[model samples]
Target: MSTSSSSFPSSASSPPSSSSSSPSSVWLVAYMKLKFFTRIRRFLRSKAPHKRNRAASDHHAAEKPRIIDAVVDDDEEEKKDTDKSMVLQKSVKRLHFGTWEEKEMAAEQIQRLARDDVSAKKLIAELGVIPVLVSMVAADESGRRRAAIKALLELANGTYTNKALIVDAGLYTKLPKNIEEIDESTRQEFAELISSLCSLANTQSCPSSYEIISFLISILESKKSSIETKEVSLGALYKLSIVLENAGALISNGVVQTLLMLSLEKQLSEKALAILGHLVVTLMGKKAMEENQMVPERLIEIFTWEEKSKCQELSVYILMILAHQSSTQRAKMARAGIVPVLVKVSLLGSPLAQKRATKLLQWFKDERQAKMGPHSGPQTGRISIGSPCNPREAEEGKKMMKNLVKQSLYKNLEMITQRAASPSSSNLKSFAISTSSKSLPY
Candidate 1:
């Protein structure tokens, strides 16, 4: 068996037979070698399919880029969400427990974050960062206060809940007691924050504290205040005036007088007039405005600005509100020569201005009718025996009284007629200079 096995292996499994001198054997060996090399080359060139790749066995094929991108996007979203949460936690911690400088740094970061993400504003407020920032607003260090105010401003932008939190924090009391003393940039930042928080006037129950309104009024009255700062302060006052309850505070602080002064400035007159309009709806505001020296005259001056239609409309609206139901205000307005301006505005103002001017004109007309009832009487010469006095003297008295009563009205009507034909009638100037305070009954 061993000998047969060895002989079989040598014949079948060993290298090609050494008896290759024969031509047939040599040809067979050459053909076998060529076929073996061909098989080896084919194995090297082709790819083998794995079970996982059986569905797309084509060479170099990969999954679509969109599919990979979608997976990457989901992973990134999760990572971003985690990062946001971590940042929020860190900010809250720093705001609560860190030193003043660290807290200011955190506030700056929160401002940047809040400016970018609306949802983050509410979340950060919920984390109670607002009160901390508000406290920091009163810091002795200007840098720290400014950083806190900037953060509060960003948080208050367009987010009602955040503003509510800020107000609840009593941000008004946090306002610098002496606004004029602060640097311009810091003061402007404070004014801007107040303005932003004041926008909740209509929505929030307690729109702004009295401190806030007074602070804003002080800023407005401050000679040191820049135009931009005053403008922002005016905006805050405007918001506070929206609520009738706030009118008393505004008036008590003499905001009416401040607004009147501002109304004289062409650049600031529009906002000043707008706030006055808001305040004019209340009785206290009306009285304050009526008593103001600049009331109708300042507003009357605003009427000449044909280029300032908005100012005209606001000025007229404020006048109408002031003139409504208050004969004293009407008397004042009449003395201020508001008639000729209203006449011009009624005819040649903006659509809104024209409407308001016409409505105001109607009020004047009604007032006239109320004071001077129908003058027409029986023309008949029939005189009762019971009547006393002479005919010639009576006739003279009748004509003289008629002339006196109709004189003021005639003068106004003449001006209106002349001004209607020509916007800048000389008669208006004459009437304004000549109209008697006692001749017209408001």
Candidate 2:
């Protein structure tokens, strides 16, 4: 070793250089290169699975050729859903009572109520609601069409103009064809509508009344109807009879035989009686009598029937009217057997019925025997009193006479009491008793 203090400089211990691209530059470049390698490793690890899956998918997609088909199917399904929504909207339009453009979405509940044929027609005549609903009913299904027609009849009740339009629409002809084709509920509605039209015609002015009668007669003659339908048909005939009676043309319009037929129905017996009562009154009333003479003998058939409660009831009511009319009518009534029926019903019927019956008997008895000469036998060939009266019949007649007198006395006392209690009350007792005495046949 040299004695000098200067030692050879070790390469590891050399002083650091201050140059720009020295060790620091080399270290920075090495760090950047390391980071790049780490990033590359991570990307390779992540992309391996995705690359394999992509390869498999592309292979399968090529093999099947169904990708376009799948896409088309999805699009078609979406379109079908849209179309279904539109069809539902249209169905609603057909059934609803309002306008379609109102974009009115009706609930299922509302559809049923709005579909009633009768109610629909009735609503059509209302101020703004009619035109829209009528259009719906007319253009809709056959069931709805029928309902609308039925409704029109109800709407026509007080309206003359609507009635004319309904006829012009040919509703009557259109309705009956289906009357034979529809269900019971529909048939009932159909018949009722026809009846209403017939009734409305009667209420119309002049010439239309006769036209209504023709329609009703046609319905009666049709073989397609049931007994019930026939009964209603006959009822319409009787209604026409009333209008004719008012017109003083009851007999002129072939009403007598029609009325007689109506009287024979077990179901319509009461209606028949009412018609007869009206006819009797109409004929006896000063206006009707001034125009016509001779009661239609068709009215006398009621006297000869197998006497049921209803028939007897009618017999009493008619007798009451005839008994109160002039002596000539009373004589005619006696021959009709109205007198004996009155006595029988008085003794055997319900209290109110018996009272009415006995009262008529008493009233009819008041007339002298001479006045009853005309009523002694049947005036019409249609009526035949098959058997003769015996001693028992005469005795029964006498007993009924006694009961009538007693009832008359009791009614008088009641009348006097009522008059004292209420001065406004009529002297019903005195009138009833006196009339009874005057009409007595003895």
Candidate 3:
């Protein structure tokens, strides 16, 4: 009612102020309004139906409880493993049942499992299958006995722990007894088991070295034993010879003579030679071989045999050891004509054989030079002791050589006689006497 005829302007219609009247200002205002409206529209558009639904679902999920099934899956997996272990355990337990069919089936399963080291260890450790296997070794049924022996062999082949388990289960004692009456096939398996057990060093489950050696010797000496039986026995002896104590036992049990005889057989010579080589590492073994008298001769003969390249190499090595032991042993080797064979081997043998042969040749050369004096030249051929010498010194040298030969011969005779007179030599007296007579100096 008090208006003086003036009107207020609305925003849409306002115009013509000094700043707003310019074209640039009008455009700026229009742009600002358009930009603000555009931003509002974009904000409304960004809250889409699908995006809102996803957010609502995520919020609902977070608000709700999560029931984890991971533990359930892990438990299921563990249960499966437990079930498998239980099955294995049940199968192993069946081995001890009194029924023949059950025992045989259990043994067959064990044989299959024993081939795997993991399964073998499980059978022995987790399942305690060794005692059952030992009992099966004593079973009167041949098939069960063989199956048990085979299973044990597989188990023993795995680890030292498995071998000790077998031993603790009385396999060592029971195996020897089983070997007594079993057929050749079963005997071979028993022998193999013994060999495998003995291969483990310092195992209490192994048969005593003496018992093992005696058993092997008897097998080797048995004409009724199959070649495979004797071979495995020889292999066991070879393994046993690695122990120093066993070396003494092997010799004391007359293993050397058996080995020496076996060394001549075409099929067994390599193993026999390898065993002999090991045995001679000990002082007692060397003495035993030397006392046997035929050992060196056989070795020399093997070295010269045309088809025995491996045996020849071993023989050369063993002879080198024997020669290095003493001058007398070297002289004995020389008397056996080993020196010439060594020279031949040096010239024509394999590289390894040639190397060993050269060393031995040099050793004999040094030995000869020492014996013949420093000025002595190498001998080209045999010299006659009766040949006259022109110079006095030459004559003295010849006489000295003759005396050395006679002394060597006498020394050899003395050794033979002494060996013959010993009680142990009673069995070998005729052989020693004949050897001495043949070696006598005319």
Strongest candidate by lDDT: 1
Error of 1 at 419 (Å): 11
lDDT of 2 by residue, 1-442 (tens): 1211122222233222322477876565455434533443333333222333344456457655465565556556545433433333333333332334331233222233334334433333322223333443333355654545444545666555555556555554343332344454544445565566665545543234444444454444455656676677666655655563443454445544455565666676667666655565454332342223333243345444544555655555555555565666666667756655554444555444455555555555445423433332322233136666778666766766665665666556444333333223223222222333344321
Q: Tens-digit lDDT track for model 3 on 218-265?
A: 778877789888988888888877666667678889988998998888
Compute the lDDT for candidate 2: 0.47
Worst 10-residue lDDT window, candidate 1: 428-437
Regions of candidate 2 where Cα sits further than 4 Å from its true position: 1-190, 198-208, 221-224, 235-251, 284-310, 336-338, 369-442
Candidate 1 Cα errors over 4 Å, as ranges:
1-64, 74-86, 203-207, 325-327, 362-442
On residues 1-442, what C-alpha lDDT tens digit does candidate 1 reach at each position? 1221122112223234444478777666556544533432333222222322332343454666645565566556545554555465456656865677789889988998899888667667866688899999889999998999999999999987788888888887777788767998998998888788778887754554678878888888888888999988888887787777788878888888888898888888889988887777666877787777777898899999999999998898778667766788888889889988888887788766776676677778778866866555535465667788688858866876686668667557645644444333222111111122112122
Shift in Å, residue 238, candidate 1: 1.9
lDDT of each: 0.73, 0.47, 0.65
The better candidate by lDDT, 2 or 3, is 3
The model with the greater TM-score, 2 or 3, is 3
Top TM-score: which candidate number? Answer: 1
Worst 10-residue lDDT window for candidate 2 reads 1-10
